[model samples]
Target chain A: MSRHTIALAQINPALGDLERNLAVHEKTAEEAIARGARLVVFPELSLTGYFLKDIVSSVALPLTSPFLGRLRDLSRRIDLIVGLVEETPERLFYNAAIYLSLGEIIHVHRKVYLPTYGIFDEQRYLAEGGRIRTFRSGIGRSAILICEDMWHPSAACVASLDGMDVLISPSSSPGRGGLEEGKTFANARAWETINRAYAQLFTCYVLYANRVGYEDGACFWGGSEVIAPSGDTVAKAEYVSEAILVADIDHAEVRRARMANPLLRDERIDVTLQELERIKREGAR
Target chain B: MIDLSLNCDLLRRVLIGFIVNEVRKAGFSRVVVGLSGGVDSSLSAFLGAEALGAENVWALLMPYRTSSPESQEHAELVVKQLGIQSDVIEITPMVDAYFERFPEADQVRRGNKMARERMTILFDHSAKLKALVLGTSNKTELLLGYGTLYGDMASAINPLGDLYKTQVRQLARHMGVPEAIVQKAPSADLWAGQTDEGELGFTYEQVDQILYLMVDRRYELSDLLEAGFDERFVRAAFAKVQASQYKRRLPLIAKVSSRTIDRDFRYPRDWGK
Candidate 1:
């Protein structure tokens, strides 16, 4: 198992200032690198302010846009992930995660689930994405999911299907009443099934980062967490400050844990997969 | 002299990080700052990028004929270092032709004419681009009534009105803002050879420090002078922030009944809810 330090930037970006955000990323990435981090991550919609007034339409960029290009240039040697708005010509705005390594975008994940209740009008601005997949890089196996994707069991199930060793969920969650406890609860809720079922039954890691700030009216509580194989939060960033949470994974533990259970071999997918496919096709139509 | 050491490196960075997140929550993905090649607009652009990502921020360089190339160069440098997109639009024709009808105006009037014209172009692009206009005026400017009411002072949102002049400079550094912008003499660039300190007969460092200690820091005038600030500068700065208190506030409309427009019944930028 190779050593890698994952650094999370719990930053509060201003509304609609692309230049300043980029500079902050550059500076912070340097700091993370100095701290010996090989992987760096930012919260959901870190590029454009989350609310994104009308500017969302104009500032929205395609993959080839200068914005991602700059990030691509910066991602050399550092495995980096960022949450941003990706404009698709099909009249769809994807809540996307661009996974970068060695200065190239290895894989991009579009959010499978879009939240539309209370303070989230995602359906109005973003197009829903299907087909949850994971990327197998040379070093480790990982999967990407935005904030709302963690809310469902199917997301982790889909990622496990791809044999992901770890799942990274970047988020921008509002901070209101009982902020820290609420975020901790949300992280546990999203991770319990994956960490306990998958980590114990199949064995894997769960990584997540939520943004922090007093946005228009609602504040984003930044309480990022890293859940280990035993379903315990091994490490976590504080709730309301800009800080990084770095953690290491012992790959040997993964092989040891999975072999002890051999649960993947006992899976019965025929009935369940067919039924899920039927639901998926019907929902898409 | 103003004391800006209160906004220390860590405190300033945290405050900046927090506000950037605040603006992000306000339903704006991008900001289009009118870079007049002046201190106020430059600071606004820098802060906007910190609040949003550099990719989501845009800067519009609206220059008039009298606008100096030196200032334009500075504006370009600020945008380039921050990695923001910028466009230079010359507003000379629009201003000159419109003002040709009222040729008997003085330099101040002509300068104001250019200022208003520049704002018009800014808002037009803002509408087309769907960006929130980021205001750049500092607290000292807001207080002393140095800015045009709706012209220079207008913005969909402003992040700097809370900071006095000296604090703005200190923040500029923590932001890793280009030194050229932080060190340059303040200027509105409305006309050639015009400097903000020279025109106002007081430097920003003096006025801002004075305003901060007097207002934000809540120091007495005698204390400020005792602390080595010139008596005249302290008095003028305090009076300005006090006299222009009206400009800093939302417009007050007479209420015959229960609620007034912007005072009691404000929830969001849009009243749809």
Candidate 2:
């Protein structure tokens, strides 16, 4: 059984201030390292704060940019998962999360789902990513999912079927519609439900690192957490405030949950692929 | 008698952060606020200072000759307390020049002229200082169209637009604004002794509650009346809200083209990005 200590850096980032945000990233990484965390996850667009319209291009960094080099320097002793606005040589932009280990970028996951609805306009400024998959990481086989990507159930299915042990969801979900009712953070409430469902269904460790702080009237409710394979929260952070939440995750729990309930073993991928193709043909009509 | 509880401490921190991000997002560090010493303007100034620092926020006191002395003094108290740079621009001379040509102008005409004239001063300073104008109209006033169009309503951005007048006072007091300013009767100070509640024939406390039910909660007119609100008050407030719907929207386009600006050629307000 493998054990990994993960840290979720749920901190406020100033918009368009790369230097200051980098300093914050460095500091948080150091703290995570001190706590013996094998991996630290950051929220969506952690390098260049969210809600960048035209400024997205201005803050876009290639993986080879000096900023990644700086992050690579910080990843020498501990693995890091941070979000950045990535620019290709073709000059297109993508909302991507880069995985760093052993002083190098190990994997890059471009967000497949670009949310364009209410309060989110990522599609207008960023190109859609082509795929989602599981990759071998310093923390074992894991998968990276950006803010809106996790909303699509199929994305998580692909990761789980590809044998991902841990699923990392870095997000900047805004707090909405709590001024008059039940939960103070309705968005966070939905997130908890969805994340727990993902953990229980996929029989894998789920780590969500969401940002804290208000940006242009849209408040990012942090509440970053780690959910066990049995769908119970292991650790949680404060809402609307910066917090470094750490939790110990065991791969043994995944083995135990999957052994007890063989949900994945029952998945008929050949049938799913055939039906998906048929749906693609008939969906337009 | 409406329960309008607000977490001012949490609201303040988030709003301050909102102001800073909104102002910076627009590529401007400085903001120009027309401080009338009222709770709305005071709260805006306080949040602006907290967001962009006291040095970046500029407060302008544009008062007509008929404007009360208390208004100017209270506005000055905010400027001093926030330590923001300020200038007092007297609009009497500019407004009187036009009014002298038509001495038969009524209070409404003169008041509208003063409001527009004050906006002119704020916009001119915005150009000179390279700052965006911070709006001060509260949700209660905005719903009833109590403010002069293209006057106090014109701004680059408004933080208090979502907050009701009663909530503004709550935040002002929470932010430790001068008690003299927060406790005063709500007034636009457009004319001599022209209080907002007095002119509207209803207190903000009453209207805010009704509007909260009617608008925020989306309760129908019959629902409000059934909820035991006074019929006359409900009808009057609801009628004003219905009548003033035009003020809340952008100027109507005639739709001469297949793609019209603000209609078919629609995009978010921050589409400049």
Model 2 stretches with alpha carbons more than 4 Å out: A12-24, A61-67, A88-92, A181-183, A213-217, A256-285, B1-5, B20-37, B45-65, B68-94, B116-134, B143-145, B154-157, B169-185, B192-273
Best by TM-score: 2
The ten-residue window of minimal lDDT in model 2 chain B covers B264-273
iRMSD per prediction, in order: 11.5, 5.4
Model 2: residue B270 alpha-carbon error in angstroms: 10
Tell me what TM-score chain B of candidate 2 gets against the true chain B: 0.97
Q: Which tens-of-lDDT digit does each residue in B1-273 have in candidate 2?
A: 677767666667667767776777688999999999889999999989988999999999998888899999999999998899999988888889998899999999998998899898899999999998999988999999998899899999888898889889888888889998999898888877778889999998899989999987779988998899999999999888889888888898788887788654544444332
Tens digits of per-residue lDDT, candidate 2, A34-100, equal 8989889999999888877657877899889987788898888889898899999999899999999
Clashing pairs in 2: none
- Residue A34 Cα positional deviation in candidate 1, in Å, after optimal superposition: 1.0
The parts of candidate 1 lying over 4 Å away from their true place are A178-202, A274-285, B1-273
Score residue A14 of candidate 1 by CA lDDT.
52
Model 1, DockQ value? 0.05
